[model samples]
Target chain A: MKKLYTLIKNDLKLIVRDKTLLSFLLLPPVLIIAFKFLTPILVETAPILEEYRVIIGMFASIQTAIMFGFVTSFLILDEKDENVMNVIRILPISGFYFILYRLLFATVFSSIAAYAMITLSDIAHPGNLEAILLAILYGMTAPTISLAISTYAKNKVEGMAYFKGIDLLLMLPIASFFVGSSLSMVFSILPTYWVFHFYETSYNDAPAFEFFAVGFCFFGILISLLLFQFRKRVFGR
Target chain B: MIHTKDLYFKYPGAAQNTVNGISFDVGAGEIFGLLGPSGSGKSTTQKVLFKLLSGYQGSAQIKGKEITDWGKELYSQIGVGFELPNHYLKLTALENLAFFQSFYDEGLDPMELLKMVGLEKDADKKVGEFSKGMKMRLNFVRSFAHNPEILFLDEPTSGLDPSNSRILKDIILDLKNQGKTILITTHHMEDAEELCDQVAFLSEGEIKKLDSPENLKLEYGKRTLEVRTYGSNEPVIFDLDQLKDDKSFLELVQSGEIKTIHSKEANLNDIFIATTAKK
Candidate 1:
């Protein structure tokens, strides 16, 4: 338990010191705020812009999810490149504990970012508590999927390559929403798809709770298994 | 205590074993040095002992039990410092130490460790800003922070200045005196000569010679003496064996004509080079 706390604390210190984290966590929130205020002025003069709120909201959620995914992937890749895993492996702590810390950190950071984005946009005004909780749940899943992909990555460059490839595949489900298709069944298989579905349904008049619960349970198990397999292969017991 | 018998390790796709079927024992509180050149399997030996690499072919034991039988509990008693300094570059030196110190049950004081390594003033500086020597010193302190019973240090003094190197040597000696078993791997003959109780010369994944520095030197050194004398305005060399019982040799020595007289005893470097070169 102490070792896990140390690892998590160390990671948090580094994350706080990183300039990139600022750009990653703050930039999207700032952009959403800018778009929120700018849309009113532009839409008053141009009637075509008034009907694009839902599209903008979807775009915002997708953008937020991708940013979250990139941040989680890059963080794991950085640690791997620095041989931090090797250092951690020599410690008396279990692999499960080390991974749990990382997952928790990523989830908390992602949740904060999600809440900030929603609060800034002011379009989907779910109460602060519901928004925070839903974001936390969704945020936790991103890092698991990203970390699982990182297992096959040998270095940062390769990890980024795989991350981008996976991002494209994941974006397919989000893209389904823009096309006005009800493809929750297909999106159910992709963890990010459920995250997007959860966000869209929570604020708008849609069935998000049922989809969120089912998607959370399903991906939760799958990702846990994938994380275990990864931990075994990369850091043998 | 460490014991290995017919231990073998080969990296995947390698043609020959990186570590051949070699056997050795390191007793408690012993300073065992693995002396070898690059790619001579010294580091590989240390890695195996530290459980960094697995899938070996033979038996290895630590603390009177097989390595395969040991659990995470074994790590609490062991510490490793790699050839290269492994630290978070963005973190201050203090933060780095504090982070690793938290991994162990009993840890040395980070401030005292930094002071011992002569990095006390730079504790707040980021490790990325440190020079190679500074980084090496910090690496030395990191190994001792856990107060481990067994220490595996690879090239511990590779990049330090003389004074800092001496400090590190003193710390290693101090640890040894405290009854800690230390395994040090280095190509520096002087380190083995000055610090190790027993040194092993490794080449091509095999130990060429293993013994105390004094014993190895005595065993391999020449028994003859070399006498240098000024004769007719020129220096002349006389072999001790050639004048063993000669009256003229005594007369020469008594007349003070000899400029210098010294036995030809091999140093640790000579023995190391000769032994490893042969293999």
Candidate 2:
């Protein structure tokens, strides 16, 4: 536990000191704040269609999760390129703890980022505590999955390319709503589909237990893929 | 403290083995050096001993147990200083040491170690701000922070100036006096001669020669004595075995005309070039 704390503390210190990464993390929150003020004006000037406000809220939360995942990937790639992971591998501490710690941090950061975006955006707030908690849970998987897939990238440049590419695709689910039901089957495979669907359906009203269950089901798949890919790519076993 | 038998290793998908058949032993409380030019399997041998690389064909044991069997617990018993400086750049020197020290259940005082390496004044300085020599000094001292039974140092004095290099060698000797076993890898023959009890000269993944520096010199050096006379600028050379009986040798000694006499024993650098034949 002490070793784990040290790893997290040092990692956070390194992240804070990294100007590029600090900016990467700051961007999502900045976008959320932008939407917070912009949403009222957006709502006032736009058509009677209130659904775009929900899109803005989901955009902020989802983008926060995605950007933060990119942040985590950047640090991981740095550690790998610097051979810090190999240095730590020789320690009495298991290297698994490093990966495990990142996983937990991603979950925690995503939840916090999600809550701030939803509540501060003030447009698509979950009506109840359960839904709020569920929204946070949904927020956890995007970055987790994103960082997992990012393990394939050899360095930060490649990681950025991967992030920008995948993040652009994550927008597919948001656009799928506009394109109507015809494209739902093609977009449904993405984790962000459930991410967008969760907020779109539950903005003002409390979602059913089954709705939360489906979100968890998608999270389970993402978490599985994450573990399997991490084991294959970064672990090289 | 370390034993390897016909060890062989190949990188993934490489055409040939980076570490070919080689074997040697180092006793407890001894400083053993693996000396070679770059890419001569020096670093590979060190890595095998430290358990950083795997998939070897032969056996390697450290402190009497097979390296493969030692697991993570073995790390606490040994410390490694890689040739490359691997500190977290943004962290202060003290912070880097303290953070890594926490990984071990037992530790020496990091500040004391920093002080030993003359880094105490710069403890609060970020590693990124450190000069290469300062970083090298910090790297050398960090391996001792855990007080491990064995130390693996790969080119511990690389990039260090002569004064700092001498200082580091002094501390390394001090660690030896404390009964710590060390495996050092370097192409620096002077360091090997100064510090190593036994050294292996490696060439292209093979052990070309292995012995103490003195013994290797004795075997390869000319068995002659050079006597310099005051009047003549040139020195006269005599076979060592004939020195006592030869009238000229004794006459020069008694005549007080001899400026200097030196046994023609080879230095480590000369022996290294001859043994490895690496330019």
Candidate 3:
């Protein structure tokens, strides 16, 4: 427990020191706000402005998640490239605990970024406790997927490549303006797509418990297993 | 303590074993050095000892039990300082130490360790701003912050200037005095000569020679003296063994004209090069 606290503290210190955190955490939401203001200028029609607002807002949320996910991957890759992983590997700590510490750190950062985006856009405020809980749940999924991707990357450069490719595909559902709304059903399998769905659906009314619970359980199980396999294959006993 | 017998390790897709059948033992409070050139399997041997690589043929015992039998408990008693500095550059030096020190159930005081390595003044400075020598100095003390009973140090002084190297050497010797068994791997012959009580010369996945520095030198050295004397305004060299009991040799010595005399004993470097070069 002491070790976990130390790891989390050190991770937080490092994150705070990074100059890129501002661009990563704040820039996406700022860009979304800018787009929201410029929507009328780009499209003088109210119908087009409404469509643009929804598309930009959805894109903003996913951009936030992907940005935060990439940050987590870069951090883990940096540790691996610097041989910090090897140093910790020789310690008395279990692999499970090591990864848990990283996951916790990433989750905290991603949550902050997610909340900032939600506030800036003022689009979908999940006011109730259940809605808020689901938002937090959505935020936690990004880091787990990021950790899984990092396991396959050999270095920072490769990690960025993987992040870019994966982020591009994951961000596709938000491109509904260009790709057509017919594709949303196809892309809904992606976690970010579900995040957008949950955000849009929650404001109308509390989502059906079955919808949130089932989606949460499925992604949760998948991420848990991915985290386990990543720990075993990349960081062997 | 460490014991390995017929240990073998081959990298995936490699044609031959990186570490062939090699056996050695490190007793309590001993400094054992594995001396070799680059790609000579010195690092591989150390990796196996630390259980970093598996799929080896043979057995290794640490602290009187098979290494495979030891669980997470083994790591609490061992510390490893890698050749490359492994630190979070964005973190202050103290933060880095504090972070890693927390991983162990038993950890040394970070302040005392930082002070020992002369990093106390810069404890709050980010590690990215540190020079290579300073980084190495910090890395040296970082390994011991867990108060490990055994240590594995690879090229402990590779990047340091003479003064910093001396400081690190003193710390290593101090660790020895405190009864911690250490295994050091390096291509630096002088480091091995000065620090290691017992060293093995490795080449091409095998040990060419293993013994104390003094013993290896005695075993491979000529054991004869070469004398230089002035003969007709020119220096003449003669082996001491060749002039034994000769009247001329006695006359030259009695006349007090010997310019220089040196024993033909080899230094550790000479022995290391000679033994490894043969393979």
Candidate 4:
């Protein structure tokens, strides 16, 4: 626990020092604030848009999760660029645990941010337990995308390209609502689709228990596969 | 303190083994050098010992346990200094040490370690701003920050000037005095000659010669001595074994007319070249 604390403290220091990463760290809050203010204005300007607040809220929350994942991915890439990963592999705590801690930290931070964004935006009024579960389910996207970017990208430049491409794809699940029923079912393969569906069901006064179960299974399988790939590629384990 | 016997390893999809059937032992309180040019498997051998590489065939032991048998705890027992300087460029020198030091249960003071490497003044300066030599100094000192019993140092003086090189060598020797076992991989023949008690000359993943520097020099050196008389600019060579019976050489020495006499000993560079060239 002490070692994990030390790692977290060091990462916090690194994030605070790097301006680019600091901006990413600050982006989620800015996004939440922007959504909080902009939603009411849009509701006032076009009362018809009031019914689409859930869609608007989905953009902020999901984007916030993606942003957190990218932040952690950039940190991993920085460690690689600096060749500190080699030094880290020889440490008593080992590189595997260090990365595990990063992924978990990103997941937890994104969950809290998602909760804040959803509740503060006043777009979704689910009970506390339901809201927390939905936010936590959405949060799994953090580690999934984090591992995906860091696993495939060899450097920060490549990481940015992957981040942008994955960012656009993550938002694609929302497009399922505009498509035919059969086409909508096709989006279920994407882990984010279940997250989006779960949020949609919960906010619309329906039990999202089924979406939560499916999302957990989808994220679990994808994350496990990515973790294996990450270990093989980065640590060569 | 460390032992390897017929150890072999091949990289994935490689044509041949990078470390092929090499073996050696390093006793406690001794500095053993693996001297070779680049691509000669010096670093690969070090990696196998430190558990960075796996699927290696044959046996390697650290402190009486097989390297494969040991887990991450093995890292706590050994320190590694890589050939290249690897540090958090944005972090201060002190921060880098402090961060690495936090990995161990107990570690030496970061400031004292910085002082040891003459990096105390630059402790607050970010590593990206450091010169190559300064980073190399920090790399060398960081290996033993946790006070490991064994050290693996790869090109410890690679980027340093002569003064700094000498300082690092002195510290290595000091570590030897303190009963620490050190394995160094360097292409610097001068370092091998001065610091190593025993050196293995590696050529294409094979040990061409393994012996003390003095013994190798003696074995490969000329079996004669050169004497220069004060009056003559020309020096005369005499067989070393017959020095006692050479009355003229003795007379020259007795008359104080001998300007200098030196045994024709082969230097480590000559020995390395001659040994490796054989392959």
User: Which candidate gets the maximum TM-score versus the true structure?
Assistant: 4
Q: What ranking emerges by TM-score with the best candidate at the front?
A: 4, 2, 3, 1
Kept native contacts, as fractions per model, are: 0.49, 0.70, 0.81, 0.85
Question: Which stretches of candidate 2 lie above 4 Å from their native place?
Answer: A23-30, A125-138, A141-150, A153-158, A180-184, A201-237, B228-235, B251-260
Tens-place lDDT digits, model 3, residues B1-279:
989899888987899999988899999999999998788898988887788877778888889888778887888888888999999888888888887777677788888898887889999999999998888888889888989999999999989988878888899999999999999998778888899999999989898899999898888888576667765555555555777777776777899888887777788899888988853
Chain B of candidate 1 versus the native chain B: what TM-score? 0.92
User: 3 or 4, which is superior by DockQ?
Assistant: 4
lDDT of 3 at B64: 86
lDDT (10s digit) by residue, model 4, range B1-279? 999999999999999999989999999999999998889999999999999899999999999999989988999999999988999888899999998998888788899988888899999999999999999999999999999999999999999999999999999999999999999999899998899999999988999999999999999999899999889999999999999999988888889888889999899999889988743
RMSD in Å for model 4: 2.3
Ranking by DockQ: 4, 3, 2, 1
- Clashing pairs in model 2? none
Residue by residue across A148-194, what tens digits does model 3's lDDT show?
67788888778767877777876675654355678657876765566
TM-score of model 2 (CA atoms): 0.89
Model 3 CA deviation exceeding 4 Å by range: A26-45, A51-54, A108-137, A152-162, A175-189, A193-229, A232-237, B105-111, B230-246
Worst 10 residues of 2 chain A by lDDT: A141-150
Summarize candidate 2's per-residue lDDT along A1-237 as a digit string, tens digits: 677677779888988999988897788778778878888887788866476777777677777776667777777788777667667777887776777677777777777777777887786776666446655665666556555645678777887777777777777788877775877757878767776776777765746555566667877777777777776566544
Name the better of 1 and 2 by lDDT: 2
DockQ of 1: 0.53
